[model samples]
Target: MTVALASFSKEKLYPPAFDPGGLVYFGPMFDFVIGAAPDGSLSNETGALEAWEPNDDASEWTFTLRSGMKWHDGEDVTADDLVFTINEFASPDATCGGVCGALAANLASVEAVDEHTVKMTLKAPDVNIPAQFGPIEGSIMLLPQHHVEKVGWDGFESDPLGSGPWKFVSRELGQSISYEANDDYWNEGHQPKFKKLDVVLAPDQNTRVAMLKSGEADLIAISPDQVPVSQSDGFDILTVENTVFSEILFFKSSDPEELTHKLEFRKALALAIDMDEVIEAFYPEEAGKRTSGDAVPFSETTLGHDPDLEPYPYDPEEAKALLKEAGYDGSTIKIWTVTFPDGPEQKDVNEAIAGFWSKVGLKVEIVQSEFATLKEQIDKDGFDPAPGVAVTGFPTSNRPSVLTNMQSLMMSPDAGGSYRTYWDPKTADTLHAELAKIVDDATRDERLREINRELYEQYWSIPIAMKNTLYAAGDRIDGWEPISGISKVLSYETLRPTE
Candidate 1:
């Protein structure tokens, strides 16, 4: 079976935690320590972990490995491998982002008690640890210690090995990756249905659609606009709702003189954009749900979501008033918009937002860049060096824990830091510290709601809309289901030919 994706990484594909695009190829080749269920809840059915439990105060967790699990080289999958994986993720030099940041902050120690048992001690009692370790963006996947020790990190990157149902065959730097069925895969029920899998990168949506029609590709991920085209062509279009949210993240400038440091300026920018019109112009009704005050896209069903919270009303005049009240300096604020694999229309949406800001007496310049360039900038120089505000997709459904979401995005640099930082360090640290210690479900829920309310009022970020992920598949493929609550992670094991 063949699949076409929008983008692929040029770098060597090891330490899978760093690159989302790399995960498309390497994800099926490795198993996670924990897995998330269809509804974004914790599950042990899909990973190497057989069972786990928290101690009396919840500060410590013990995990038991699944019996008889073995790597592709026939090495037994044990607690030592899990220990090595966690330590690598927590390493200070690791390029991993939010997920590793959370682990480093809370994990006091992780040790293999026996061949099948591992014990983890935390700095604080956190119920969200399992969710952070699940198979989601930035989450750690179990790595074979023996292979890495033999090959070294760089060697492992060139030739990786895992215990997943699919084994890595070969990959072209920027074009494609191939895999073959692991006949000895531990999970009997979830064994690979097909012998070979090929994933190719075709950044152009039109080309991807054409490939699908021409029978060159069995499955392709399509954007919201392509829904009609795929539907009309009679292709099976699968959608996963509330997978991610389009958000305008405001970066705190190091210099206090910058306009970005002012909360009034950020609030004015938020109030200026008309999300309803933006949604209508660029997105399908099913894919575009206008977000309210909360930075994270949380529905009523999502934990810690406040349903009573309403969206900020569109009032350009009020935005102008706020700008004037803050002593308008006429400084040009740049809104950086990058091309995302899933949401190609982000540039158009950002143009509309820039127009709205311009009408509110603000000097707004829309700077368009590729996602790779922007990521490189942020990696070299922190968030402060980038544009004041950036339009990007923030995944929420895949991360069910609200505390984990906040810790990953809102915390300061000193406190194991977040990938995106906009809040006051002292306040954010205190709230996160307090929330992390709560063991009771009721108290945790209330505390989470309070934090959301605080962030909502503070204008942490501008939430545009919750986006639904859409995938189009041809008739040649069968028995494949879109992984719920996940945007790009594909279950290659369950995929089989129609015959």
Candidate 2:
């Protein structure tokens, strides 16, 4: 089987350093301790751990590995490997953000209770422990301790070893990677249906669609705009809705004189843009839907999602009034648009938003750049002057809990590594800490709703739309369904061929 991806990272193929795109290339070669099920819920059924239970206070957890599991190198998957992996994730060197950061913050100690059992003690109770460690885009994966001890990080990257359904065959930098099926895979029912897998990088959307049409690829990720054409071409189209949330982030400025620092100004910016028009113009009906601030669509399914919260109404007249009340001087407000991999129409969406703002008598400038360059700039020169407002997309499919999403986008930059800097760190951090300690479902859900309400009321960021990921499969493919709510981590093992 061959798959074409929209992007690939040139960085080393280490799980710790992987972005969502990197996961598509290397994820199949490694197994996870817990993962998102097809129904968009977290479960240990498909992971190395057979069962897990928490102690009386929910501060300590015990994970029992499935018996007879073997690593790619033939070593038994044991509690020692789980301990090593968790310790590494907590280490200072591990990439910390999202769930990884959550684990690092709460984990007090991890030990190998026996060959098949691992015990983890936390500094404080966390009801979202499973979610924090599940195989989401930003979460870490279980590593082979023996392989790493023998070869080190560099060597492991060169020749990765894992207990996944596929084994590393070969690769070409920035071009393609190949893997062979692991016939001896522990889970017989979930073994790869195909014998071999080849993943190629075709960053351009047109190029990827062309490859799919020409029968050069079995599957390709595509934009919504290409859906009509692909469907006409008789290719099977697969879609997963509410996978990514595209929004405009308001970066905090210490200078109160700046428009972004003013509450009315932020609200004005939110109300000016007409999301319905934007969706109609750039996306198909099934591909996009308006969303409330910091919350993705289908909020009912996501924990902490507030049902009453609605997207800011499109009221240009009110927006103009608010702008006037804020004493706007019509200064040029730059909205940075990035060539993000997951957001194919980001430039178009930002352009439409700029037009809306212009109609409201606000001076808006669209500054275009690559996502990498923009990220580098933000990292180097903390949010102060530049990046006043930028258009970007975030994956919201962190299963079993939405706190991970809230932590990343709503929490203070110092605490959550959020790109948005306008939030009050002390207040957001305190709220998050409180939410983490509660174990009751009803209490947790109520608190989550409160957080969402707070973000919406404050205009934390301009909620735009929830985007559905589209994919086209060739005729040779049969019975392949992507896990809902996750845009990354294409479960190649689940793909079946036409018999």
Candidate 3:
């Protein structure tokens, strides 16, 4: 079977490091102790983990490895390997950086208790530790210590080893990758039913769709606009109201008196654009619902989302009034966005926003760049002297926990999370400190409410719409369905031939 992806060809087949940031390398190449189900629920699919428990202080966590587990090379999986991988990820010099740093931030030490038991001591208690380790967005995954130690990073990247359901057969850069079923895989029921698996890197969305139509590929990722068309051709369509969002991020102003710094200015900008129209233009109705606050609509199902709150009305007149009251001349404010595929035309959507903002007596400048370059620029010097708003998207947590939502979506930038609108280092830390002390579920709910309200009240960043991710597959694919959450790895083991 062949699968087509909209993503570009990866330069490296596997990560060269043993860290959480490098977990993407492990996803296709290795197995982890725990993984996320299609709906984003954590599960011990491979039985790598028998059980786990946290100590009384909540600072120490102990995990018991499933006995008799073997690596692809037939080496016994032991507690020592787990300990080594964790410590390596925690190390500051890890090659895979940002996420690696975030994953190991609170780690104090990791020790092997015995041949089957491992202990981790954290500097601070974190309730969402499991999610951090789970295979949600390629965070925590295990590696074979023996193979990596002997072969080293360079050799390991070229020739990776793992006990996953599929073993890598060959990879042709800018072409395709092939794999075969891992017959010796511990979990027999979940093993790949198909004799072979192949993935092609078709970056073009139309090309992917065409390939699917031509029977060149069995499965492919499609944009919302392409969903109905694919369905019309008798292909199966899976739409998940994912925890993904398209939002406008505000950067701090070089001058405190600038329009970007004013709460009224931000509010006016929010009021000026019609999100409903935007949604209709860019996404299918099945793709997602409009969001009221900084969070996506799926977040409303969580603890803190206020049901009574309403999205800002599209009122250009009010926007003009607010801008006038804030003493803003018709000065041009720059906005930026990047090119992306398997989604709406971001450039056109951004231009629409600029047009709406313009109607309210604001001059607009639109700057465009590639996603990678723009991301680098934003990370290094967030609007530095060249202050402007940048357009971007964030994938939300599929977990039903408030901690998961906050940590992944709106936690402060200093906390290694991406809530950079207000750009305060101390805000998130203070809130998290308060949250850590509250043990009552009801009390935590109230606290989360307060936090959610505060974020909305500030209007630092405005969420435009919640995005729905759609997947299309031919009838030959089975056991696959549309899931509305952030599970990066679809359990390929569950996928099989329908015929």
Candidate 4:
């Protein structure tokens, strides 16, 4: 049996490439060796790694591999393979971006302890170490060391080898990608029921929906607005609250004396916009909830979230008063957003924010670009200190007690992307470093609560709302589950055919 799904990608599949353009095509081919357990802890159910423990004052970590795991070529998986994959991430010459680069920032060394065991040393102690290998998108993905070493980086891109349930078969760029189930897959009871898998690339949302309705596609991703209109016949609409926070960032300019760098200016801008209006305009009534105070909205479930803090109230009058006190010289402030696949048009939301800011006597300019271009600009040198505001979703993790989200989203540019925060970078980094050393639950909780309060009071970044991810599946598809770790992670592993 063959299962057909709709995926959006403009290029062919390329494994081990950290570029966003390549990651879009990598989901079906690669798998995170470690997966999150039922309670949001790390486990070895996927046979990526069976067990791991920290030693040497929490600076060194030892990992034990699961038995009987094999690569697509039928080669036995070993600790050497794991070491090689991590070395690629830790290499200075790697052109990777996003989570791969962020995680690699702290990797000091990786050594093979034995055939089934590997040990990793870190530059600093981190309580969120396991998440680097967790099932989140952009986390570490295991690669076949033999193939990569023989063919080299450039050659391996064209001939990718993976140990996941699916094996790459063929691809027609911007059209479709094909894969066959790994019959010799070592992991038991979790294999895909289908013999063959085909992913049709349809960049248009309407075309994807039409394909699902016409039986050309069995499953497709759709926006919340399309859910009500597309859920009539044999389709099942599955919704999951994403571990992502859609927020507006206020960047500091290269010149420290810029208007955006002023605390009063940033506070007034935050006060002028009504989050309820923004949520109601772009999101369906049941799709998104109003969120404020937290850097990542879903972070309330994390350890650092403070429940007692209140969000900044929406008051245009107060905004105007603050602006008056700051010396009334009108200047056009810039805001940026980009287009995304099967999601709300963020450009529209930015325009609404501009309208709100304009009412408070602030001149606003909404800058738009493609997602790829925006990411490139954010990663470029001196981009962090550039003066402008941009709108994008901040990614959080599913780990219940981890500080990975906090360190990535707010602490430093190396952990987080190059996005600038409202507070002093050095001070924020120092505070987070101190937080990382605490292993006691009580001490950690108290420190986290204090940091959460500071984040709210300092207005680091203005959080807009939490987003809901929606997927459309057909009647023939059964046993399908909502995505857990990251959006679109391991979706095929849990699916089976009803007919």
Candidate 5:
């Protein structure tokens, strides 16, 4: 009844093991022992985790395990599979991990206790341990030991065997991907109702929308400008807040004489832009509003979001004055935007932000690049010339216990996430000490908040409006809502046909 339209960049189906980004689609198909919903709510939203505990010390974690769960291959679920998978995935020789290196650091070992029980002991008492169990326990899909042991974890190329709701049917690179529902899925409580799903690799929005309108595709991610057409086409519109944002980058160290590090200069630009207008110009009704910090929008944890943290709202006059006080009359700024094909409002949004600086006497130059290009560029540039400004934000499990990530970003040369603020010894020592604390969750969260506050206060990057992570379902679809900052997009079982 409901047909959903989605676009993929390349038609290649790589092994999920080596492909971290590829997991985005495969995630909903597979299940994790832990996860988040689209709303930023926990799968066990009540804060009641049936499998693990948040209050426990990082040195020891107990997974109570779900009863009667089985892999897609009909292998009886056991604790040993989890232990085997964890050790294999987190091991250093391999892992398509964003956090596996760090998660692996704390994990001393993973061992099965009983048939449905596994325990993890850490090398130290970690305060931010719950962060490991991200929206889907912060790891990718749990691998089935039966298959991976034979194929080898890293060698399972193009063969994605999992205990997920959908099984891979066929794939044609740069063309299409088809999957069939798993009738034997153990977690039937959260399985998809659809018999089949197809993901066509069409990067152009015009092409995608055309396919949707022509009924060649049943559902498509509608652009704000195309919302009317979607409604006219009788497609259901779903919009929700997203943690993603874009920004102006400056490798200030490259030009120490530049105003990139000047607080007033940053504040002026922040105050000059009308983000609401940016939202309107690009996103219209489907636009998501931003919060004070880079925290996910519409989070349960964002209830106390400081309403007073005001953004500069198109006051070119205020912006001009701020720049003057900072001794910045006018200097050309090179701005870069990272975008993916078929992503939302990308060009208009980037252009709109650049326009704000231009209005207030700032010379702005824009550079745009594809996802892979951007990452490659960043890898090459690193801290040598930090992006004058770059837009980046990740989905959160609960407020992103960012200390672990922040510390790693700031300190680890290997990980080299943009925390590359070259430092005086005093500044370095102070920030490092704050990061190395071993404490309880309550204490750790407080420290983490302070770190986030400092990052914003220091004007590391301008906090643009939080965009909504959206998926368009047709009118024939029901029981779907764009959840808040909760992790994971949709439960496969939640997709019931409307008509």
Candidate 6:
């Protein structure tokens, strides 16, 4: 059995509606209806489930589940789980807005027609329906409705019930939580190899690092800074390139022709980013390497991987000259960053961008706030996109909320589609409509792939380097491979103890 150890802070666990930071302790205790595969393919890459066909464009999606699966609770996991999950996320009453709400805004209704069948009808066609099934995104691992519906949304989260390889055993406020294997788990025949698992909240990086070093902890999510010294610490390293992209988002609420929308400015900003140095500063030579692709490379669909969009040549002078030509002697640009959990890399990225703009003759002012503060500032009617450079993504559709949310809905949570820059609604709508007209999945993927090109070619917003997620897992663990964000870090059931 695996004896993996992790440092986690559980200020809360949930009905999962409100807890974006989910059962940080019992993550493996749930299963998704459909999953994103390691290669970024949605809907079963693990030899688990087969692709089900869609009946019609009523936007109703039908999934025929693999048979014989049951909840860890020994109760049958029926179509109801899938139906409940879909309705929960689509309902404004849902606590979790996991990224599905925006993409599936056209969802009209959902129903589990039978024990093994689930059907979802949309207000409009959404090609990204399958990608939204995970707990990380909006569609969640099914909750034991008997328990949740009985307790209601508020109470159900505290004592959530689910069917997984493990069961929720005990939780101790802020310190740690533990889970024991479900002896009667439905997948008992599949043979989940571990007997028990435990997660503890160790908020301090140094403390977490020490816990791992001393064998008190077996895994820790790494920061770019911790990777360097972590190299010689005698642990095997696993790198998972993530699908999330962090960029210098531009709101451009005031600048109409968006002179700042120049490719030169985006290119200059891209060029000015010294990612390698920043990576080196935070990660060991072995862990730090430059990565590309508009989003994580794998998710870019072959068409999105445009060589023309490569990282800018690192030349501050060239950048300055470009700005000069644009008549930008460096007007004030607002720089927003998360302060409470400031890692060296996040801080460095902000400072570098600010200083680079300054060198280019722009006045730079730094604004440090937590993710919430920045989000609040950003969601406002007049939020300036140019001022914030938050790391965000539309993992479900590979579309940028920074683009959609701002454009159509004026930054309202209910915005239809657009980025914070609110680049162009008519254009995005046209592109999406064009893709919908194409019936084949391959052709549709190709159509979706053009988002990056349009973002850069049309100067919708600034594009930054796509990143790889680096999680520190001890070599003693096996099979729970870090497959990017393509699924919840492989199923913990696969993790077998090693000596």
Per residue, candidate 6 scores C-alpha lDDT tens digits across 183-268 of 77644533466666666676667777877777777666566666656777766555555434455555553245454555566556
Question: How well is each residue in 1-499 modelled by candidate 4, as lDDT tens digits?
Answer: 3333344444534343454334435666665657664344466776488887887456788888887888888888888988987887666655444455555777888899889899888888865666656655345678788988888777765777888878888877667767888877776566778888887777678887778878888777777677677666657776555444567666553236556556666678789998788888777743555664554422565666676777678999999998887664886677766655434556677788889999998877777767667666766765643333545433333434545554544455655545554446666677657866776657887887777776666665677766565667877787565355455453575677887
* lDDT order of candidates, top first: 2, 1, 4, 3, 5, 6
Q: lDDT for model 4, please.
A: 0.65
Q: lDDT for every model?
A: 0.74, 0.75, 0.65, 0.65, 0.54, 0.52
At residue 189, candidate 6 shows an lDDT of 39
Provide the global lDDT of candidate 3 against the true structure: 0.65
Worst 10 residues of 5 by lDDT: 295-304
Name the regions of candidate 3 deviating beyond 4 angstroms.
8-10, 13-26, 45-47, 93-98, 253-258, 292-298, 301-303, 341-344, 381-385, 392-414, 417-419, 436-443, 481-484
Assess the local accuracy of residue 377 in candidate 1 as a C-alpha lDDT between 0 and 100. Answer: 62
TM-score each candidate: 0.92, 0.94, 0.88, 0.90, 0.82, 0.82
lDDT per residue for candidate 2 within 1-499, as digits (tens), equals 9999887764466776666656778888887777667877776677778788887657889988888888887889888989998888777666645556667777899999889999999997776777767665345678998999999988987889988889999998889999999999998867899999999999888898888878899999888788888889999887775677776676553336567767788888889888889878878866767664444322555777766776678899999999998888867888877765678788778888889989999887888877677666766654444424545343345344766665675566566555544445567677767877787879888888776777677775676677677788999899775677777767888888998
Q: Give candidate 5's error at residue 499 in angstroms.
A: 3.5
TM-score of 5: 0.82
**lDDT tens digits, residue span 192-278, model 5:** 677887766555667776776666765555555776666676766666455444343334322455565677776776777777777
Model 5 lDDT at residue 465: 53
lDDT accuracy of residue 480 in candidate 5: 60
How far is 78's C-alpha from truth in model 3 (Å)?
1.6
lDDT of 4 at 189: 62
Find the candidate with the highest lDDT and give its number: 2
Question: Model 6 scores what on Cα lDDT?
Answer: 0.52
Better of 4 and 6 by lDDT: 4
Worst 10 residues of 3 by lDDT: 16-25
Candidate 1 vs candidate 2, lDDT winner? 2
Model 1: residues with Cα > 4 Å off, grouped in runs: 253-256, 297-301, 372-398
